[model samples]
Target: MSRIEPPSTDPVNSKPARAATGDGLDPGGRRRARRYDPDRKTRILDAALDVLAEHGAAGTTHRRIAASAGVPLGSITYHFATLIDLRAQAFARYVEQQSAVFEELLEVVRTREEFVEILVDLVHGGPARYRSAVLGFELHLAALRSPDLRVLTQAWTRDSRAALARFTGPDVAARLDALLKGMIMNVLLATDPEPREATRAAIVQTLGPADGSRP
Candidate 1:
């Protein structure tokens, strides 16, 4: 029997295979990269929120979010199948956070002064808080295009209006929610140097009764 020579082993390139695990590409030799962790999903989602808020839904791509989160591009899809999936999750988180904050504010809101003050504070933020009011509106506009988003948005509106109705009447509360939404859109687009007074006045007028007393 002819002696079989062991197949000549060619050493991997000294530079190290660019296709290795740390190279960001997935395990199947595909160029798509991925990160491994449940936390990574949340991190990517949060990063996507920041990117989307900064650049709008049109600007929110997997690559952008991965770069922001310092993760691999494929990691986004590992957690979310489509951009809409990510956007839906991000919007859900956004609404949840806003609800929690507003609930806190509502706890102490006895008069229009306090209510408006808290609302403005939450909207405007302190010098140190992340101020992305425009970005928030961008997300809202993006969500309006999707049915899944509409459900969440409507639920959020219904819950909030119901809460407000506890203070104002149901009719007034529903109207107040609509009025506030319009005011928010205006605030996002307005160039006025000081619209707080006008905004506050609008809120007060909506909450106050016809003769400044409950019916």
Candidate 2:
């Protein structure tokens, strides 16, 4: 019988193969690792809000948020260096999205009655109202303890007041802002929530007639 030839061991003829692990270098010397996700930062910020809404700021952490975000733990730090930074960005996003919703709703209101109806709908019922209510309280409470967060809250208040000022004038808009805040809190927390009509009346009372006449 002829002797069987051993397999060739020549590196020059061998096919290129990737590293089993580590840096994932291929035989051709190129890295074969997964490409970085461009939207990972936004995902992390959104996940941070979901975590905050569910667990409050105290319960939000890199590991928990990483799992929630479906990202590597390192990605959290890669996007936001500190928990406070993550919270701030998440809250900023929340405020921006909420403001956009308000703008959309307010844009279609041609009269004071329509504006009151919109505010009533916002407090009594609307999309994501309850979830936003919870997150709003979480952010407000967190801001109490964080001066940096308080700045964001103040900015949010200024924006809301500015939006209301378009209809209520600056003086009434400030009071209306306060009224809306209180009404929202009551609607979210009270065992017997105020009726939509009652809320509307309260708004009208605070801001006077929505018929263009200043209160």
Output the lDDT of residue 135, model 1. Answer: 50
- Best by TM-score, which number? 2
**Cα lDDT, all candidates:** 0.63, 0.76
lDDT of prediction 1: 0.63
TM-score of 1: 0.73
In model 2, the runs with Cα more than 4 Å from the true position are 1-34, 210-215
lDDT of 2 at 25: 53
Worst 10 residues of 2 by lDDT: 1-10
C-alpha RMSD by candidate, in order: 14.9, 16.9
- True-structure lDDT of candidate 2: 0.76
lDDT of 2 by residue, 45-137 (tens): 889889998899999887888899998666676566466667778888888777777778888988767888888888887658988878888
**Can you write out model 1's per-residue Cα lDDT over 1-215, one digit (the tens) per residue?**
11111122123321211221435555776765333466887788779778887788887777788799987665666666566666677776666665565666688876656766766655455432343455556656865764446655665676678667766779888988887766666655568633677777777787774444432
